[model samples]
Target chain A: MEFSLIDRIRERTAQARDDVRLGIGDDAALLAVPAGQELAVAIDTLVEGVHFPRGTAAADIGWKALAVNLSDLAAMGATPAWALLALTLPNADADFIDGLATGFAQLAQPYRLALVGGDTTRGALTISVAVHGFVPAGKALTRTGAQVGDLVMVTGTLGDAAAGLRLVQQGGQDDPRSAWLIERLNRPVPRIAAGLALRDCASACIDVSDGLLADLGHICAAGAVGAQIDASLLPRSSALLDWFDDDASLDFALSGGDDYELCFTVSPQKLAATQAELARLGCGATRIGRIVAGEGVCVRDRDGRQRATARPGWDHFAA
Target chain B: MEFSLIDRIRERTAQARDDVRLGIGDDAALLAVPAGQELAVAIDTLVEGVHFPRGTAAADIGWKALAVNLSDLAAMGATPAWALLALTLPNADADFIDGLATGFAQLAQPYRLALVGGDTTRGALTISVAVHGFVPAGKALTRTGAQVGDLVMVTGTLGDAAAGLRLVQQGGQDDPRSAWLIERLNRPVPRIAAGLALRDCASACIDVSDGLLADLGHICAAGAVGAQIDASLLPRSSALLDWFDDDASLDFALSGGDDYELCFTVSPQKLAATQAELARLGCGATRIGRIVAGEGVCVRDRDGRQRATARPGWDHFAA
Candidate 1:
């Protein structure tokens, strides 16, 4: 029965990738990484209630599972190559598996990422994805290279997913604009191309999985620098602005997580090229702030006054 | 709090490996796969109640979680390199985490397997491990090469784990030999050295996680051949024999899972060398069966008569 389910998944996710010497069936997958390229690997796990709402669609869960891991690769400026999924389901629900494979394939097809191997078990619903990508030696972006005075930039709008979550929790399912926000929450686009373009220009990079303020704080800690973001400069989707007050939307943009957008630091000299390159990729870059000489992350109002927040962002254990 | 836990884990498992350009604390780990080597990747998930009993020790869980993934690499004749762990717990318990990390480090230190990068989440306890290893190009043993008349072999004694599990389930924890059986269940050693030695000689190889009969059946199905095991020749540990009668012990040997031992097929010409090589590795190899002209797996009793069993092995969904 397990074999049959594996066969079903294999049939659905079949693709022609020569680099995958062996796919799903074997005890372990055989992959050939191009010579001189380093392999970038990341893993993330999503539980039914903790990561997503209890009743979230399996298709959305599948997409988000791979997207989160791919976002990690994107933050590293690596080109995704293969993924291994370890799926735990409450039962063998064929429809759920079909929906999940469809969603996973939809995102994977764009990057040509192969589902090389995985395991399925009977348990509480949990999805774990480990992605492998290739980055040219000495070229991967990291969160420890930000220097004082570097511009902190982000790709795409923030607060949409957080607003979407708010609408979801408030039972705003019938709102016409809710679809747009919910889509942001359910299907996030990993900034892979923008990351690749910023590989040489960006001094430091990270994905906004823990909200902008919290994630940027990581950069500050890693590079032993500080950052100050202008609240008014934060990018928010039209839907986010329309659904909430200015202050509420700004708060979400500041500390609401699950955006999956790339937040990077670029030196002033490379700012123009970085902006133009990301613009060409269709996810225009937004300059939010600058790396400073102090410690931790600070947010300033449009008038340049420091603003206080109750807390920076979500911490799974703390919450 | 999450960061502190991660720091604790990183400090405990720290090792200096030059190939690991970037380890934990990065968005993604950067690893260099030596030129002319293929990467072998495998993932496995262990959930509470499903993979292990409810009261199992955290240390045992951690050791088994990694051991299972390493066994997958061993089946492919790959030397362990690095591992990514995604640990989901009911809550953040420092003592539990410490115990688990200790168990994991105990197994990993021998192979020099570095704990690279991973995620920790809040949910029902689950440990998903993805292991990365390197095998020389074209040397990976797979399940597709078994030819007619190949000698079927397995490493280490079988059914001890199964017997151990039975004892645990039957409330025999206080028995004189229960500790020995329970140890087998908790810390089944992966035969990495034996698998490495069999790389050149074995036609097909797989790890026995789903009982000898079920796992061997996979080899037959993949190679499109048949197999017949001589029941009398099946290797049983003294503990398993002392715990159960001949019939029960033989049944456990054939269909009890979680052995984490390698099962391989070698041509008659390589049989002697394979046995000698594995014996030198200290685990030794046992010849229990051979590839036949037909399909499926059959077991012959001492009188050379075919014996029928109720089922092959454990299937998550089917069970």
Candidate 2:
């Protein structure tokens, strides 16, 4: 049998790079990691009906599969480079492969990310992507560096993707606001530029993949420091606000996931510089909270009282 | 939700390497690539009832997941160093996770391949592993270099795994020979030492995952050359010959896949040295055929007449 699916993907995502000595054909890929750089690697698998809704567009699935992994690199402040895809399909459908490749290339072209190697197997529709990026020695951002006095911040709006998912699930995609929310759910923009600007200055950084509370909880756990965030300070997209009341939108923003926005902590002295750098990149940043001495994340209302989200953060194995 | 599964894996596969600046529990792993070394990366996905039979033990699944990827590195003549696992399961069962982690670490510890990062999600059982290795710049093996007149060789016996699967399918596993064949199927040894020995000597190399004909066909297709092999000289384990007739065993050896042995081509002058070096490593090499001028693989009987096999190599998408 001809694996023309691979052929089509190769044709579609074909990219030329000096560092890729061998890409997508041999027993494995041969890549030249630039001298004085550390390799940042991340892998993620998206299963139909679990990671995405049951009938998400193939293009959207392809774009989101790569975007989430790139978001991981963004959290590390790594410059995206090469990727390996292990895509599982229910069958060998050429059109699906075409759509997936088109969306994948659309996201990859801007970053000069090369699709180095991949394997296609017959199974449930699932895509696993392993991305490798470069970060200068000792400069790669991590989740273990938050200090007691660092200010916590997030890039872009948070609740849009989650609200989009809710809108789609509820069949609420009739108006422009719903369309924007659904787009957020389908194609999240990875903050690669903002992350690069945060390197060496951000005390700790993580992409709000599992929502602000849960992912920020990770930074707190890793750093042994707590964070106190003012819920009212979260930047909400106008489209999200149009569909839901402030309280509902805030709940989604606080506990909903799939945002792909960078949530980071930085020293107060460097806060202005970090914000300005991100501003120049056009990604922008919003101050939401600050690191404290205790453990776990604390969410406060506009009146400075503790608030509880209606839903916990997204968990893969949640009952 | 408790993602204690990750903690379980972290405890079981905790390996220390100075190069792994940060391993699991991070947004992306930070790994130091040795200076002047090119990185070799490969990814493969195995799905239940496709790559392996249904109800296969989690440990075997985990072992084969990493083993097949290591075979790719072995084919490239690279030193295995790090891996990222993306496992999809129907549910997060502790016993299953334990078995999988144990099996993964069993193979990983020997090569010091750190489990750098992973993602687990709910779905039909599927495991995708991306393995990264290192080779001196310009020394990595590839399939595009086989020249006409190069001796085609393989390390270890082939078709045992395929035959073993056949026995299990036929419910023929009641004796020691059956047990041995099943073991071959479950835990195919990757020829890392033999491949490393091939280094600059072998003109081209490929792992025999999709059978000898299909995989050798890759080398031929990649090099625009053909190959001719004598069926009588094809290596088979004693247990395979004991269970099946000569003709059937030959067919299995030629077209049946899942054999992780290495198939390579070396110039006639270096053949003796390559064999002797592999012998020092106790892996042993067998000269099975020669690269010829043309395309595709040709099998010959002892009397030198072209022979045809009943089955083609394994195609994941084949119906």
Candidate 3:
């Protein structure tokens, strides 16, 4: 039965890749990273209730599980290559497995990523995925390269997923805008192309999983710099702006997490080129702030007055 | 608090290696798999109640989690290099994290394996580890190389861990031999040296995570061959033999799981050399069977008559 489920997954995710010498069904997988590239590896786990709503669809869970890890790779400017999934299920529900495989394949096929190997066990429902990707040696972006005077930019809009989560928690699934917001919450688009474009231009890069204020704070802390953003400058989707008032929408963008967009820093001289490159890729970059020589992230209004926040971002343990 | 916990783990598991360009602190880890080597990757997840008893020590859980993954690498004759650990806990238990880190570092330090990156979240206790290793291209031991007329051998002893599990489950924790048995169950040694020794000569190799019969059956199926084993010749540790009667001990050796020993096949000409190499490594090897021309595994009694069994090994979904 376990073999059948594994076979089902393998058949669904079958992609012919020459680098994957030995994939699923083996005790371990053999992979060949092209000769001059460094391997970037990341792993993330999503518990049923903590990561998604209790009754979330199995397909969404599968897609998001792989999406989160791919986001990590995206943050590092790595091209996705392969993934390993460790699925803990409450029982041997074949339908759940089939739905999950379908969801995983949907995301993986676009990146040409192969599902190499993994383990399935009986337990509370949980999904863990580890992704391996490749980046040219010395070219991977990191959080420690943000320099003073660099322009702080982000790809795509923020706060949509967090708002989506709020609507879901408030039982607003029937709302007309819920589908769009929930889609943002459930199936985040990892900015792989933006990251690849930023490889040569961005000084520092990070994905916005933990909200704008918090994730940008990570870049500041890592690079020994500070950042200031105009509260009026945060990019918001039309749905977000239409759903909430000014302060509430800005707050969601500031402190609410799970955006999965790329928050990066580029030198002033490279900003135009970076924006043009991203525009060509169809996800235009939005400049929101600039790096300064301070210790933490700060936000200001149009009047140049500082704004205060209770917390900059979400911490799982703190919650 | 999350950063502090991560800091504690990083400080404890730090090992300076040139290939580890970035470790632990970034969105993803950057590793350089040496040129001309293939990367071997494997992942495993162990849940609280399903993998161990409710009150098992955090340290033991940590050791076993890494041991299982390392055993997979050993099966492929790959040298361990780096690891990523995703730890899920019910809460922010500092003491548990500390103990777990200590246990993980204890096993990892000997191999110089660095804990490169991972994620932590709130959930039922689960430890998912993805390990990456390096093997010379074309040198990995796999299950498809076994041929007819090859000798079937196993390293260390089989059934000790299963016997240990039985004792623990039966409330015999305080038995005179309980400590020995429980140790086997909690911390089975991965035969890295034995695998390295057999790399050039072993026709096929696999780690016995399932029972001897079940795991060997996988080899037979993969290699398109059959296997015949003399049940009486199966190896049993003195501790296992002294605790159970002949039939029970033999049963455990045949179908009991959780023994992380290597079961491999070698051509008849390589038998003496393989045994000598393993003996030099201090684990030694025992010849219990031979690869044959049929399709499934068969067990024989002293009179060379085949014996039938209902099932071969444990399956997580089936259980």
lDDT of 1: 0.89
Interface CA RMSD, all predictions: 1.0, 1.3, 1.1
Each candidate's TM vs. the true structure?
0.98, 0.98, 0.98
| Segments in model 3 whose C-alpha atoms lie over 4 Å from true places | B1-5
Q: Which digits, one per residue and each the tens of the lDDT, describe model 3 over residues A178-253?
A: 8898899899889998888899899999999988998999999999999989888899998998888888888988
**Please, what are the lDDT tens digits per residue for candidate 2 over residues A228-282?**
9998899999998988998989999999899999999999999888888888899
TM-score of 1: 0.98
Q: Lowest lDDT 10-mer window, candidate 3 chain A?
A: A1-10
On DockQ, the candidate that comes out on top is 1
Minimal lDDT window, size 10, model 2 chain B: B1-10
Q: What is the Cα-based TM-score of model 2?
A: 0.98
lDDT of 2 at A156: 93
Rank by DockQ, descending?
1, 3, 2
lDDT of 1 by residue, B109-132 (tens): 889889888788988888899999
lDDT of each: 0.89, 0.89, 0.88
Q: For residue A286, give model 3's deviation from the true position in Å.
A: 1.0
